[model samples]
Target: MEKDLLKTPIEFLKGVGPAKADLLKTEMHIFTFGDLLTLFPFRYIDRSKFYKVSEIQSAAAEVQIKGKITSIEEVGQPRKKRLVAQFEDSSGRVELVWFKGAQWIRKSLQIGTEYVLFGKPNFFKGKYSFPHPELEKAEDFVKSPMGGLQPVYPSTEKLTNKNLNARGIAKLTKALLPQLKGVIHENLPVRLLEHYKWPSRQDALFQVHFPTSIEALELARKRLKFEEFYFIQLSLLLQKDRQTVQTKGHSFDVVGERFNTFYAEHLPFELTGAQKRVLKDIRKDTRSGHHMNRLVQGDVGSGKTVVALLSMLIAADNGYQSCMMAPTEILAQQHYNGLSELLEGTSTRIALLTGSTKTARRKEIHADLLNGQIDILVGTHALIEPVVQFRNLGLAVIDEQHRFGVAQRAKLWKKNAVPPHILIMTATPIPRTLAMSLYGDLDVSVIDELPPGRKPIKTVHRYDSNRLQVFGFMKEQIALGRQCYVVYPLIEESKSMDYKDLEDGYESICREFKRPDYNVSIVHGRMKPDDKDYEMQRFAKGETQIMVATTVIEVGVNVPNASVMVIESAERFGLSQLHQLRGRVGRGADQSFCILMTGQKLSNDARTRLETMVRTNDGFEIADVDLQLRGPGDLMGTRQSGMLDLKIADLAKDGQLLQLARREAEGALKEDPRLQKPEHAATKQFFIQKHKGKVQWSQIS
Candidate 1:
């Protein structure tokens, strides 16, 4: 057996020709013999236990029995047809049914022949039956010596139609296993393997697909999962090591008058302990003279913006320029306005260079930037344009950095002779396990606490039937000089549908609140930029008591007086979006409230989301639940990261395993960073071979 043989094209396999190979690749992504071997079963059926028909009492459990067919018949019309066979054992009789594949089943069945049947028993209308049961002649049944679990591979209808169902796949795997006897070799170091007490690569692979016992199955799973995650962590940590050792960065060594003045006199609120700790971490990175690649994660309204501003102030104090890039124009504008207001009396020159900026203003800002006059620049993707040059750009603060593509962010690296220190911020909370994998290269800072004097936004769930009560509560809050937001989800995902919903909601608010006493503003994504800005401005200025809008206002809307948020059809929104929408109102000093309204009928996920929102204001907890609801791939959109190309390891359930793998990888790298030692050579070669062309490790943020 040779290692190269495992890399053979799947089409050349005994049971798989070109057609079946193509189907396997298209349906299950099994392209090579290696892939076919690694396609582990999703579940298994126990072949050891056989029960008599009369002994079965509950449909809750599945059972296998040996029985003889007494009679076979086809019943009902063509639309709702079924093939029924009366099966009898020593004590009693039961009906075996098939609603599909009846023709093949009928041809295969032999009356009065003892056969083995496996399926879940169902007591329907007081009659015992087994639906779509698996059957085979007793003589043909292959018995496992240990009564082990029979693997059930995943297959699609297209493959099943071609005689490549779960059983068919298992047969192909059995055929491939003999060829892989000594071909599979150990990749990890002997010491590391012994420390973890993991099975060999060959043993793990063999046991994973065809386990002789439950313990063997679990051991195989653990070994494979560790291998997958360990390599990912090793790759990431190695990238980080390279970046830290090789990359030179500009140092903001001084916290001069600019920073001191802002903190002493101009700071609007006291920073939370978490914010201070993060700021300290940033300060250390800047002073360390290493290209600071840091990710700042915080929940909404956690004062991440203030930390970013102060970090920029430090750059400005040290005669360097700083820029903050946001994902959206609205968010950019909000940052510009907020920072400008924060630095009102200070001489820090901040410029906004969004797409909406006039040509003349843009030219002036660009010139000012190059001349080193503008201390801070804030904008959207426009900041990445070639024309937007900076004189002495030292630091970049990217808000919601995930919204930008790798190419777009990479452009900023080339803007300076030495890549500027980067501080990426995200209000969306990421689970710790996900963060370790997704953002392993960059150091992470977390601002987990909200600022002092800010009250937790009281969140509540409501049904459509309680709309009037919610509206009354809003009126009461409005009477106390606080503003309210009435948000509605789109009838469908289209902007037109969203606009229509906003319009209808606006009309209803007008009819309910009525006249000159209560003013309302409406904003949606479909509206013109100017029009949306006008409505947003009106709402921010407190000219309107209530603003009806879509999720366009989910980010960067800071109105201190807005204290109530009424979200219509909140069940349609994800947990993160709902949290962000709720964050829009709690900026004010008053006790803010968020009312989530949905129909009586809600899905289990929706119910969990709403209940989580209502139960606790902890964004991290909500994010964890969201990760469980939607796995790591969808949670952070990490499918593109290649770190999530896991076959068995689940980010949600395997956090402990991930931590262990990362720690072990970190320890291994610390011992031999380049894997130059003889024992580590195989591991290094295996990693290089596995990830050679598939991943761009440097592309990870």
Candidate 2:
């Protein structure tokens, strides 16, 4: 814990010094001893034994061979400095050669000498030569020294240039193992360690760095992986227990019959089965004695807003105030308009409050909200202002859940005597296992089905070579009097990147649709707020025939008449994001289409992404494929890995483990709520170490 406890260069750590420390820091991002301790290898290389050319397949990537040097020869110019030292083992002979670093290679290598040469033995010009391989003296090259496994740290380009590549990381690990203090002697309880047969902290660190065998490494990993899930679960359960202890609420007993009545009598549309089930779930939670912490997840245009509205109405019917906070002003306004129109015949007073509201108008709205005159208030993050108080806030529905931090979302709970029941909505669908791991404190409801009458967006993949042909299709769609959208990756390319910039794309579009009468508007991340708003307003009003922009328009924008979406370099987007962009077009009554434009040259993964877009309109199915393709962290938006975090325990590969872990965690928490007793001591210690005694991060991340 002491930052300056050790200030020695890595090379001085019994095996490293100034030069090696510089190499390690510049190459591996390792500076402090702590950094070296946590600098986990990406993989483990098996250097357990030596192999011969005859013993290895011709297609083997690499193989280490123990042999005696049969001969040595010099070839190439002085600058090239090539040297070949042929080695012969019982199975066959392989030549160890060096080209550029021959000066060191020649000093380390000799003819008629036994040595250990580690490299791929290959036939180049009718003979074998290792470009540059690891060579050790015959005496020091004890087969047991490398007879088991090798750690392969993540290396960088700088590492390669510094000649501190994979082997360098391995060397650093070997040298630092003795210096590593097992901060934990037996952090986990003895029972758990014995039950799981997990390695001790000291054993794990050593086995992971230099394992005796693959089985030991597997045991070491299991020890750490179990700790990651255990701590995460313990922290979540402790927080949940802490909150449940201080109960807040005058529980609403309404069976949500009013909503069903309103729907049956005045409903012009039908509620999907998923929506009804979700509404029932929320009603049960709200009516129960406990406060509700619920998340509603749905695909874009899956009618999540309507679900939120119904929940708010249940609160309003019970004479309690409810507020829905949208991340964007446009979405807030949309909610206001829809609710105001829906509850027109009811006594539920509703109003819209946003940052753009006049000072005079805001003052009146604030007065109304505080007096409980407004039963339903809709606004942006402006609703969180200390000045805006709700008399009896019973429900807080947040749209686009990820936009707001947990601290901000919790603000609404403090607004009233009884902390408001929370309903969070997200257009971005989450894989169920991820939703559970991340949102364990809350209940989740998913709307996997789109509403009836909404058409699936037809998708097609296009290459730049077919740009002119695509332009023809766009013109044809425009001739139908419907609007179109062309989304670009970014406003401009980065310094290193040479992709088509948005401004460049905009200019080209103008050149193609050159008629002065044609209306084309550009929107991107760099534009001023007012300018962006104006462009969006124009596009929404049908005043602009084409909206060429970035992913900024993917969320909170509603345009019904737009029938075509063209996403440039569609390979650059995540599957969820691409699906959200496509959702923009299908709102119209007319048949809509999404055209994905990717580069002519595509990798297998990129091709799979494009093909997935062309194959299905179901977001859940696409999401399942996405999880299979990109792992949970990438799909969920961040990557972190450990006992406190994780380096592996991949959610995609071990999804079943997550399920079992969740079930085990829930059962454990129910039995040992406080986690204070000796039996739960290990779980308690795990969370305490993870949060440093702060339970909040566990509740959120």
Candidate 3:
């Protein structure tokens, strides 16, 4: 068999001509034989059991019966025409109906001929009928390759119009499989095959398309899924290995004065065990002289900022400047103010650069940054500008790193002669399985514990009927010198509707609280940036007892005095958004409360989300549930990375298999890092072909 046979254009296949091939390519992206072969079936139907006409029940599902068409006729008016045929077996008879393809079906029907029929039985007024039944001669059915478990390929309306439906695709696959007998090379090594006791790639592909039994189909799926995951893990692990050995970075070898003074004297609170463990990991990475591309994941308000600040202090102690880039200006400003206050009695210098910075201030900042006078600079995307050059940038910290693209992050690497050590942080807790698949090329550290003296936010669910009681409780809390946030959902597609809701809610709250006695601040996406910032500052300064707005303050607004979070139309938000909004109030030592408001009617998923929020404050647990509910594609915007484009394996359900694949890939690389061994020749060849002409973005975190 030739190696390029599978690469042949799909139009060259026996049954698929140019017209059908064009439809396949345009509708399903199938351009070659290899692409068609790998288009695995989403489901299968068992055709082995044949039911007698007398045994058919009204509630019966899809069934096959051996019968013959005794009579045929056309019924109903011209526009509502239907082809009806009386199909008879040993005991009784059933009607086979076709509503749309009457002319072609009626002409093809053979009277008094034994045929096999398959379809779901629909129970009408007093009889069971099969609609659009698939009819095949008994002798032909016996000789067909797809007799037992039939594969059902996905199709589009355009493809189906050209006779390229599931059955049509099955015929093409059956034709292509025979040609692939010896052409499908075994990519896994013999040792791995023997250890896992799996079938060869050729046999698995065949069995997946046309299985003899349920067990064979299961085994085939397992083999293919493992192969997919194993190759992905192998690619990511190889990237990490190359980056570690080839990339050089600055070595911070000393525990210098700035770090010591901050840790010993000015530390606000004792570091948690998890934070300490992560710091130790960072310390090891920086001292190894290899560029550090590490991700630090912690829940909201889990003290990640403290870890970032300490790491930057280490860079300053080594006579190198560090910069922290945020996704939004509000977050950048918050980080700048927090870090400056934390370093207040020390000699370390810090500055902020954002889009709103004055021209004079910008020039001063740029000059100071070039002269190495600014020890640490923090800002939004402005930090990545061409003018913001660092004299000797030893480290770069990114907050909410997922919000930035790979190209934007790569720009930071070009700032210095050698790329600075990268520390990426995210409050959106990614499930471990997703993290392994998405960020496997980078080292990961998780701060799983919250700081001391912080209490878990109490969460509850309430319908609109309880609005008065909720408002009364809010007034009581306000009288105690505490602040509150009343947030409404802001969906992009329904912006006007959401804005109206916000406005109405704000007016009613103002009427209930009565302005002079209780001041309320409003902020939303439509407001000017300056106005939004002013409202937020008013609330932050304790001038407003209640802040009514949208989810604009979801990420970076920090007011420790705000102890209550009231989310309206709570069912409209995702679990992560709800969790982030709840995090806004728990920053202070006082007991924070999150009240979810919804209507009487709720979806099952919405109920589950509300219950989960009330049951636990664990971000990881919530993230796991979110992954199961939303899948890996929508979580954390990972779809943009193109890494999660999996064909068969599911990140939500394949965690154990993913772990096994990671372990196997790691072991294989450790034994033969370059894959020069004879046993790994197939794997190496496949990797090269898969990654050919692809840009390597593993150097950027």
TM-scores for all predictions: 0.96, 0.85, 0.93
List runs of model 3 lying over 4 Å from the truth.
1-3, 52-61, 68-115, 122-133, 137-139, 638-640, 695-701
Question: Which 10 successive residues of model 2 have the least lDDT summed?
Answer: 637-646
140-168, model 1: which lDDT tens digit per residue? 78652224688989999999999999989
**Best model per TM-score:** 1
Alpha-carbon lDDT of model 1 = 0.88
* lDDT (Cα, 0-100) at 2 in candidate 2: 24
Backbone clash pairs for candidate 2 read 11-16, 11-17, 12-16, 48-147, 641-646, 642-645, 642-646, 642-647
Worst 10 residues of 1 by lDDT: 692-701
Q: Candidate 1: TM-score?
A: 0.96
Q: What is candidate 2's lDDT per residue for 20-127, written digit by digit as tens?
A: 678777766667665676677668767766677677665356777777887777888777768887778887776677776666657766777777777765667666
Candidate 2 local lDDT, residue 472: 85
Pairs of residues clashing in candidate 3? none
